[model samples]
Target: MSEFSISDIGLKVGLEIHQQLATNKKLFCNCKPIESEEYSIKFQRKLRAVKSELGEYDPAVLFEKLKSKTIVYYANSESSCLVEQDEEPPHNLDNDAKDLALVIATSLHSKIFNEIYPMRKTVIDGSNTTGFQRTMLISQGGQIEVDGEKVGIQSICLEEDAAKLLGDKGNIREYSLDRLGVPLLEIALDPVEGDSKKIKKIALSLGRLLRSTKKVTRGIGSIRQDVNVSVKDGGGVVEVKGVQQLDQLEKVVEFEAKRQFGLVKIAEKLRNSDFEGISKRENIFDITENWKSCKSKIIQKALKDNSIIKAIKIENFSGMFGYTPFEGIRLGKEIGQLVKFYGIGGVFHSDELPNYGIEEDDILIVRNILKVNQNDAFLIIAAPSSKIDFAINSIINRLEEAKKGVPAETRLATQTGETVFLRPRPGASRMYPETDIPPISITNQELENATKNIPKSWDESLLELQKKYELNSQLSEQIFDSRYIELFEKIVGKIKVNPTFVASILCSTITNLERNGLNSKLLTEENIVKSFQLLAEGKIAKESIEIIYESIMSGKSQTIDEALRNASIETIDEVKVEEIIVDVIEKNQEIVKNQKERSIGPLMGIVMKELRGKVSGEIVNNLLLKNIKKKLGNI
Candidate 1:
């Protein structure tokens, strides 16, 4: 939906996907990777920007330090240790995780390094309990085909996952250590041609390939894709982090492309303009009486709380502050970023005349106080002294960058498909060897064995399933590519349940349960196998399987018969149902005789209430019809 053409936009996209490996132990320590409910440990710490060897600090680090961010971490002894909490040294790497990464790398045709060296990537964010993340390169320089065109692969790294961030208060961010130190396999790709459609195919192909290994963790938060996008028209590289769904990939790229393109246009227009190099003014003004009659409830409440409304003058920039390159975002968003980073409330600008009830007289007073000409823009923020200063300085810095074209940065994605600043892109200085974990070597024999054990290609498996099972291409492909494929085939081949029913329950029913907040993981593969076996043996009706699944998801661990006995309705014999229908008709004989067809409705409702969940509704309806006809004939 952007104004720019796909080709003229010149978008280049690459992906860095991280998936949790299904290992029994943590990547650095012997802690189990399973979920824990115990509360055993808690600690608080703060991260400071460390100067790189180049004698310079990362811009993002400097930016965060200005906001004074602190972190609080929570841990459980059952699933974490002092190593995860950064209170002690980490142990050697887990070999199972290493082997899994090697298998995946081999499948992608990547050439392994003779020796794998672990590196410490600097992450000052609170997501990592440790200030730095431990990572090691496994392989590099592979390729995959998208529509018969090769997209180059960059490198694959084995890293330890970060802790989960809980929430953030004024200066402190809370985190949970349950997911800390989980083994993560990070696969990077070379920049592909800026085709959004092709980028989508590449992502889907890579995801399916990873799932084919059958050793990666599944479900929400188990996998994440980070995209690095840039344009050839001099826009800086933008990193879009934590993209969870494949469907949103194209839209994200399109938005980024247009955003960069607009920034470039703005920079071109600002060339040789008098507003160049205008520094931010550090002065703060108390405009309480000026906005006394303001219509904005937000500003009025701020006044009541004794919060000051401060405005900064930017010369020669009228009519530009309200310019929007994307929906729901303005140049004002950059100012808002500072407000959030420093824990401020909100801000106002001069480009758009909001219905704030500022009379003509008050506007003249503000202009005279700031000495601003008609060609200038003023930024006004309502907050305490320190936060107001931080907000103004941040706005000036962003405006300066706008003159230089799009600034290269890393941003976080919101659920609404918008992006916010996370940090500046780190340079090569962030990469340093991780001294705790030793280098690992992959032998030739190991690669050969992994290749030999490679599962059948998804396409080949789909074709074989279609011919053998007499199914359509869509159903066959769905079965072949599903994580539940192995269990589905076992159920249909060993048990006597219909293949279609088994497939639908495994794929569709589980998806529906997950969407409805039920833990589909609780209904394990073994649970499905057992439930289908019971259905095949006539111990439960097919309709009752949904009840069994719901019961298990709700923490009931009984067998099919036990589950049924606990929740199912008692089955009424057909003769008993017929007798009940006849009794109901006799009781309503007056209505049955006068309106022969209408009496069946009340009789059917009564019979169904007694036989609910025990017998088919069709059988009840048929028996009700026969008894109603006989009663009317007698009358």
Candidate 2:
């Protein structure tokens, strides 16, 4: 635990959720909003930062411009067009997407704008080919309640999703245009001060509300969350981008709170010790010669590759890099994060020295060369000569910010819930009026139509689901929240299966498989519906559904027939099932003789063990009872 609670630190969090809308066409193009696996078109472009209407360039765009990276794009005609390539102007606003946004806005009680103007938000990360993203503010000012506490909605905007980043080389990044220009609905929430659990609950409430509308797309990559976290009297607001999982939201918040608090403590300690910040001229030294004869494999490899080793000294900064005011919080990790952007693996600091293959002898040599002192700390990096000065200058700049609390920046969320520096946070200078598309005016009839699409309240929806499906509250809520809710309804409507069973398998069983490290996403909607269809036709038993799902998700099989063959599961006839039941009874005659009808329960296990995926348990049970009674009469 930390020295202070969440309230003690004055933690504030704001959430911005971006949900993909299920529309038939792209937001500004006629192409379908679909991702294609195959690409037939390819092109490359270099984007540059430009002044906004106010004659100001976004700091983030300028930062990316400094890298001078080339962006290569892959496109498929089925999902992209000239608009995505920036060769043609955008078409009129997508009406279906606009209506969906209006429905969400009306449902949230937000005031919709009479005329929506499109604006270009500068983005030079290669995710956008035009060097900017087109967005429109459709409505503003609404509120949602979480646990009896109200959190305000800032604004609702409909925009185009960016292209998917495929890979990144040092000077080049590859992207796919398949996802570009897709309709996206963004919901921004006002900042709220609370603990991690409350923050997570607030996010969940917002997600559930969108899902209740049933107009948003489902599955991974269909939705993303950008979390803005700041601590009072601590660092500036930091944005963690692309958090796709709800379970990871709380962890991201908790980790960020600790990180900002730790930075504040480090800043205070530096001020208390009367330490001056790092100066590049007097503090940096080239110590490549010191590691030429080292035994460490990393050093030897770097040396062999002609990489230079540079070190930076901080006065009165001893123990600050390793200081942990909170668990897993350290300034060294911050430095490590900055170095990664420059393609450096990591940095070796005095605090973690005498480890990582750098023996005590090597540390002593470095300390002596940098002028041995108890109150000083040093960081060394091994990189190509091209990156040495840039990496060192960044380190000094970051240390300068350390004198203040946390530096304002945008960080990427990792799988482990920790955040890493991506780029400096952008400011309002990024937005300018888009001239390609005209403003859209909302009419009374359109508003009325949108109102009709507003979904029921979450609680009411869950209650209605429970009543309509004759399901328990837990099962109903599970299906209602899961990605398969729509699919569950389709399956139940098309197949002659119990609604509760369909809900359970779609929600609980698939979740269990995912928890076991299986990718349930591999099971397509057609696959599930087809499997249930087979069950309804008595070609496959309910017992075989999980087996088929597991097989398909585990990559052992791709089709229903293949999954059945791989699992050795075939639908045995009722005659065959009765024969197996008779065999089991003959093997356990003494138990049947003693237990009579009670023997059915004990024999169920034996029968299922043989008929597990081959036949239905209901059929097995009925046949076992009938045969056991007939045998009892003979006895």
Candidate 3:
């Protein structure tokens, strides 16, 4: 990647943060939000569009309908009910969730709305069984300061989270209802001006403010952010969804800004050209007979299945067809969405040809079949006759969008920080009243009570952490933002362990363990508290705290003694140390016989290995030198 200054690529970012509330039950059902039960039932369904109250359908919803997206829902009786499956009307909203939303709203200094109206936001992607998500605005127009700059808070909405989609194949998508209907508090931030650093600071500030309430769920997927980014040079808005990490958000924004900048440049270069109104030819033809020797598995499979191959003529896009703004995504991804939406396999272009066993003769043959000139790009899609027309239409639509610069679309985020087009951008008008749940009213008394009970602010938390735990400002800030801050305070205040040690492990050591693949989720606050209590009671070595934590994170449910034994970190016995030291001396008799001034390297390595993670390295070094000197007759 080339080095580009922040100013070189105009970066304007807005954040839509969704945090799941730690409610006792699902947003609309009696089932508990935190489910630990195995799924007992599974079923499949397809999403279809219904007209809005204005007697018009949302184009985005209709686009999904054309894709024939099907949904497969997995249910567990203990955690889900008919309400989640859309078979029954929802019960009353979860009050615990509503209360937490108010707590967060008050903490952010947002104005609470007197009447909360529940609305149904259209979602036809099968992530929701009801074809729409239940959402309601609670507060609006708050602001948070980042380095003396005010980052506007647009609104905060309380909504029910959608199901976790496991996977999709053909027209069917698998969903885990285990996470469905959890209450979520969504906070939208107004677009801020600055580089990635400032954007990150703003995001971190908001996240810490939310965590300060100590009322939100903490873990992977418990919180998500959607960023709507655009460049100053002019391009359509692109929404990136499900960004889980704050650091990754900066990278996503930077990358997206550059992507849009490049796209706008492309659009400008071609603006005056005659290719503006070029359209995709809709004529369909079978090219399987000519592609029998094709090496492309996708094409070969279609040929073997006797599927129809449809081609369209794209004008003045010969070399441009292979142009890519991001890795693994070409102009082809835009085209692929069309094919995916239309239930087709994929589309083939003329740019990277002569490779799929498609030779020059095949290219010429396709061009002749489509009756296009050399400067034109031809797209071919393979599918049954049932979907060939839709596929052809989708490809044409995508081509038209490509000509118009970056299309306004929603992209799904990957763990690697890349995004691909999920669907067209949803319109603002897709939201309507959710008739299933009655509108909730926020009483002034309730808001006042919540305000009174607001937790300590971030700066106050830092100061208190410093005063109570003897932590510096930097470490104190880290602990305040850590998920383990509450646990650290509980343990250190209850047990006699060193506060600094506890804080370090909670804020740093455990983070390292998680990066090494330990399941930190299993190591709860209670576990940490109990482990430290044992250490303070002289039941386990102080140095062995991390070892016990590692064991617990490795899926073992053992008492302190069992954990210590399993880790092989037994107390360093005098007899064992003497035996190991004598062995080291006997093996290195050559160095000892010389009786010259000795270097501690060889013996230090042997003793350290034997006592690793068991005793202090300093104690082992001292014992090794004492034993070595005794053997050398220097007493």
Candidate 4:
């Protein structure tokens, strides 16, 4: 319940969504576009920011180049090839990917290009092997209805996905080649109303449209969104990257809007107030000796590691540090964003003083040395001696940016729905035509075929599923939202099973398994189809669906038959189930007589041990109850 109004800030928002295509091969190579744990090959290289033909360098790329990072790539023969290693030239663009993009563009009422050409967009973040990403604009000028308002589609581009980030272990950045060269579509939209709720709904609608075509991959990293938000009087637009979760998209946009608004207020106050010595700060102080008796583990650890601790004093910035324009976000936390760039834990400021084992006397000592006034605030940070200067300057830079209100930059999203500075936003100088990829002339026949065979809208498909499968809205939405909606339809159409039962196994059982920490994504579509086929053929009981799915996901068994055998779900008849329950009831006659129906729990446990996955528990419970009533003469 945020009371903040979008109109108050004069905010405007835009979205750039990139979704991976469900193609069998990589966009530029014959290798499969799937991740593999078995990496038999590795290589390391250093990326540099090269100037475009006009001799212009990208600021963001220059920043990454300054880091002097070493990037390591892992690849296997089956999952990758030289195309991703930057040692070989790329092949032709993927046809299936083109068809999918064409279909999507047509569905969005876009005008497809008769000829498409690829251009190389410069990147030096170690996310691309060739120092650039190959992108081709396929269509332009379309619209999609969101909340009864027409949201304009700017451009649809087909591009190769970047390398999968493995980890950034210090100076060496690791990436997997498996995700590189994977074909994905980037849909750029014009700025819309600044409403956060409306923006989230628009994103959800776009995702549904893409998924309904059944041409996009489904997973955590399969899609990513870049949100650009800005307020008219605040500052330039800032781009927030790596927003994968739709549920958090609203918060991400809202946070940026508030951040921009806060910065504007800060700049206005600084301009009008009598505050002096903000830009005239001379040097950072060496305050390590003042904290010799400090008990904070973080400070002690830094001392133990021989790291340098420094402090900087700013006048007339006391309350600004704790001024929260958004929930859970304070101006002090804003400065901490720069602190993180130096790879430090966080910054200690006067706004949150008298804690962290740093006493009031400790603050007084530092203040006396820096000669701070009542309106002044100071920052304390610990870093290696070699990086102390850089850390100090990082703080100075952020304070300077605050004076201008919301510097234009690219930021990374945190799990808490907050954004932190990643780097300066790149400009148009980052792109140059890819000479290796010649312009492709698309024919009228191509568009005609794509237009004639458009995929059904996801909303229409969901309605059909609701009617034919008798699935509740929740279950049907999950199935439609997933890539397995078509598969679910296929199973229900061919198998002799209730659609509700199938939907439960697909939706509820898989969700239950995921809640317990099992990765249900590991369950292959083929395995699911086979499991339902087994149920259709009566080779396995309906109760075995969870067991079968769990076994498949856990790699215990590759197929339903193997899963059945591994779980010891041998062929057992109703008569045998009745006999087993009869024996249990007789053996527990005294307990059954005493507890009556309450004995069902212990009796069901005893029966499930030998008959789990072999027969339905509902049937076992019914027979156990019938026989127990007869034995106890309670019925």
Candidate 5:
């Protein structure tokens, strides 16, 4: 990583940020913009690639159509309607959502268009039931500064978010319509040349600017980032999609830069070496007979199921597949990624042979069949007979592209921060004017109102929070960054508690709970408020809040009362608290006489051990000090 430099490679990185708006209704309908688990409507459909008005099909859509998947859509009445199901025409655009977009545009200092026309972007990936996403260009040409360097913003779009993909089984994919039609603001930044750290900083700076508006949704899936990375000498631009976490952004960029660089180097090696390009008849060989009595379970099952086992031979590519100029950068992994798109688990290349139960004898047999060359490499794929042609063609095409540098395509980011093949990059022909909704005219009065709604910057907001609550710098920043800032304020304003404590519980305690394998999301807003209310009313000690929340999250209790019972926290009166303290002091009489004031610490611990959640620690402390002092006078 230290060896590579962004400027040296002429790397260009662009960002497309999609954030869900915190609006009351869906972008095109009156349906509430929320997700629901109970779906009343379920249907399935098969979508195909359609040419735009220009009569050119999007390469991405064509790729999806080739795979041929059945899309199963699930819809709930509360969060979706006929508009989402594509059964009825869309209603008028929601004014609140439009206005919210305007506010963000104003904050970015962008040039807003007077008339906004929605466009249909073709998407046949089952994420959109209508086979397209509705997007409108609201503004264009603005810039944000990160670390004293200016990064230009290209365009800002107000769009309808796609459906949430549930999962996939075989050739069928499931999608939930509960998230469909929600309003999202897409901000595209101009491509910039920088290293991974600078790229991450730019992303963070833009994200903070968006969040400063406070009109966007929070929590997981509320915001998404799509990164387009390309090198000057290293092939084409590769767009990495759905980078949900900022911490993963740097690693994603680093790995992608190295991957593309390595790919370019491999192409150079092929050009200089005695490499004859891949041939269909010569490279694509049917090696099914060689694996008839194989020890490998995968091969045995494929043979039993009558699946075709095809292998491709690449001349003078023995060490090339396993070549890694950089750590974790290899062409074999790249080939495996492309094959998985066709529903094949993976491929076994000659570089990694004599493994996966493919004994040395089996390797020799494949080499003999493919006309053995010491420097040549071969890869085998086992799949259904119908998919053999498509799988082989796809592999041949990828290897061909390997002769060139990287192929321009969209890739999916994995949890490990590496990216894999998703689809080809869409062209300009993928978008056309949307006709369901009319063009909306933006008035000066609306722009003025939106400008007024633009909130303070992140630094100013954090400073205001500190001043208002008298909170320390760290706690204020934590609460501001946490998903519970609004709840923190509500808890403090509604209950008689220290604001700092509230911030800590929301930021630190909940995080600690999640780290300990507890789902703190189970503690709803209502439950959290109720617990604090109980604390203010002296029904439970301040120390008991965490215990009750833990109980609820751990599934030991459902309600506050039940949690209290589970933790055995009974609200003891002052009499009981003093009695417990006196009993503890009498038991530790020697310590009281010897340590005197120091006895206060040891005695308070013993007393609280018995009455932890029942009585306040403050009350126990006062009682222990007075009783200990009186006993010392008597002694």
Candidate 6:
């Protein structure tokens, strides 16, 4: 990677960030914003692509339509409704969601638009019930500074999220509509002037700024990133999708840059070398019936199912097929991407053959069948006879594009931060006006209010929380970042207990509870507010918050009072605490004499365990220390 400079290669990278806004209701409906997959109703649908507003159809959507997939949509009464089913017209624009997007646009210094029109982005992959996602541009021409350099913000859009893909079997794909109508804030960053490393920094800086508002959802799948990378001599921009981690940003860009560079080199080599059979039908051939008794499981399965095998021979493309365009990714890996996108299982090329249980005898036959020399390579894929056209066309298209250079396509980010082909990069042909909903008009006063409503940047928020609530720096930052600051502030304002206590519960205790497999989402803010109200009334001990919360989350109690009853907690006043410590030390007097100060810790643990959640640990510690000294003096 150090061998080439990014500038010399003309690497231009842009980032598109999609974050689910923390809103009470779905963007276009009144349904609750739930994330769970459990649902009572499941229905199926089939959709096809049509021409876009420009009268140009999206090839990518057409590809999905060709697969003839069966889409199963899951819904529930609470989080999904007619709006998700497309049976009812969408409700009015969610002002709260729009306001949240405006707040982010304001913070990023974007140009607020007076009018916003929702457009339908063609997506027939069964991720949306309507066959297209509704997206509207809210602002443009913003900028954020990363490492003292300006990273231009191109545009900010508010869109409804797609359904979550649960699983897929053959042509049947499972989806859940619970996440379908959730509001998503999409921010597209302008192509920055830097290498892959600078791209990572720019993405992280922007993400932090968005998160600083504390109105964005924080968790896995709540935020997503799409990167568009292209090199100078490369064919076109390749969009890499679903990069969830900031750490993966650099790797994605690096691998893509390297990939384009290699593809360009291969193209140049093909242009100069003995590129032969120049426009001949001899490239793709049938070697199906020749391989009857292959030992490969993939081959065996296909043969058992009476499938056909197709092979494409690329003249002057032997070593190039196996060449590592990027670390851990070969040019052949690009072919594997096509197989997956086209719904086929696998593909084999001569470069990787004599392996995968294909004998050299089989290889010699292929070479003879295609009349290919040692310098030539052949690719093969097996599928049902019905799938032959799609598989063969995919291979032919990829090879023709490779000869021209890197093909413009959309890619999926892998676990290793690398990319695999997803589909051809859809162009302006994908978007059309959504006519059902009228355009939204924004007023100057509305924009001003949104700007004012913007929360403090993360750094400032941490300092303010620490000073006002006397919270530790770590706890204050966690409160801001966990999307808990709003509820914490509300509780502290209305209740009389220490603000630090609320912060501790919201920032630390609840987080720990979730890690312990307690569904903290089940324990709503109302639950916490009421529980704190109980604490203020001296009806429950602070130590019992965890126990009470566990009961509430586990469905043991629906109400705070009921949870407290199940907890069986008592105030255990200092007077009773002292008596308990006195009795405990008296019972363990011999141990106290032998260990003295060390005996205090063990005795406190024993006493606290016996009366857990009844009294504060601070009270227990103070009383136990005093008792331990008195008992030792008597000894």
lDDT of each: 0.75, 0.89, 0.77, 0.84, 0.87, 0.82
Q: Which regions of candidate 1 deviate over 4 angstroms?
A: 232-234, 268-274, 281-309, 325-329, 355-364, 384-387, 461-472, 479-499, 510-541, 544-613, 616-635
List of clashing residue pairs for candidate 4: none
* Regions of candidate 6 where Cα sits further than 4 Å from its true position: 1-11, 35-40, 195-218, 248-280, 403-405, 444-459, 487-635
Better structure of 4 and 6 per TM-score: 4
TM-score to native of every candidate shown: 0.82, 0.94, 0.88, 0.86, 0.93, 0.80
lDDT top scorer: 2
Give the RMSD in angstroms, all C-alphas superposed, for model 1. Answer: 5.1
For model 6, how does the per-residue alpha-carbon lDDT over 1-635 read when each residue is reduced to its tens digit? Answer: 22566678888899999999988789999898876757988888999889876677888887787788989999988899999998898898899899999999998899988999988898989999999899999999979888778888899999999898899888899999889989999999998657877887777677777777777887668888999988887887899999987767788888788778878877776667665532336576766788886677788888888888877777877776677644554668777778776678878988888898888888887788888887888887888877777777877677777768888888989868778888887878988888899999999988889878877765786687789989888877767656566788889889999987888888778778777878876787788999889888877778889898889877788777788788787776788778878998888888899999888778878988877888878878888888888887877
Total clashing pairs for each candidate: 2, 0, 0, 0, 0, 0
Error of 2 at 59 (Å): 2.6
Candidate 2 Cα errors over 4 Å, as ranges = 1-3, 53-55, 589-602, 626-635
Model 4 has an lDDT value of 0.84
Tens-place lDDT per residue, model 4, 1-635, is 13466688888899999999998888888889867888999999899889988899987887677566899999988888888998899998889989889999999999998999899999988899898999999999999997688999999999999999999866789999989999989999999875788899899999999988877898788888999888877667899999998877888988788778777877777767555544524647888888777777888999998988888888778877877655655668877776676567788999998888888888888889889899788888988876777667767876777777778889998877878889888999999899998999888899998899688887787887788778888888988876557777888888888888887777778878887878876788788888888777877777788888888788777777788778877658889888888888878888898899889989999998878888878888899888888887853
Misplaced by over 4 Å in model 5 are: 1-10, 578-610, 620-635
Per-residue lDDT for 50-147 in model 2, tens only?
A: 98878898888877876778999999988899999999999888888998999999988899999999999999989999999999999999999889
The order of the candidates by lDDT, greatest first, is: 2, 5, 4, 6, 3, 1
Could you tell me the TM-score of candidate 2? 0.94
Backbone clash tally (model 6): 0
Could you tell me the lDDT of residue 424 within candidate 1?
Answer: 72
lDDT for position 36 in model 6: 72
| Residue pairs with backbone atoms closer than 3 Å in model 1 (clashes) | 11-194, 295-356
In model 3, which runs have C-alpha deviations exceeding 4 angstroms? 1-4, 278-286, 292-295, 324-330, 337-345, 490-496, 513-569, 585-602, 616-622, 625-635
TM-score of candidate 5 versus the correct structure, residues matched by position: 0.93
Scored against the true structure, residue 386 in model 3 reaches a CA lDDT of: 75
Model 6 local distance difference test score: 0.82
Candidate with maximal TM-score: 2
Which RMSD values do the candidates have, in order? 5.1, 2.3, 3.5, 4.0, 2.5, 4.9
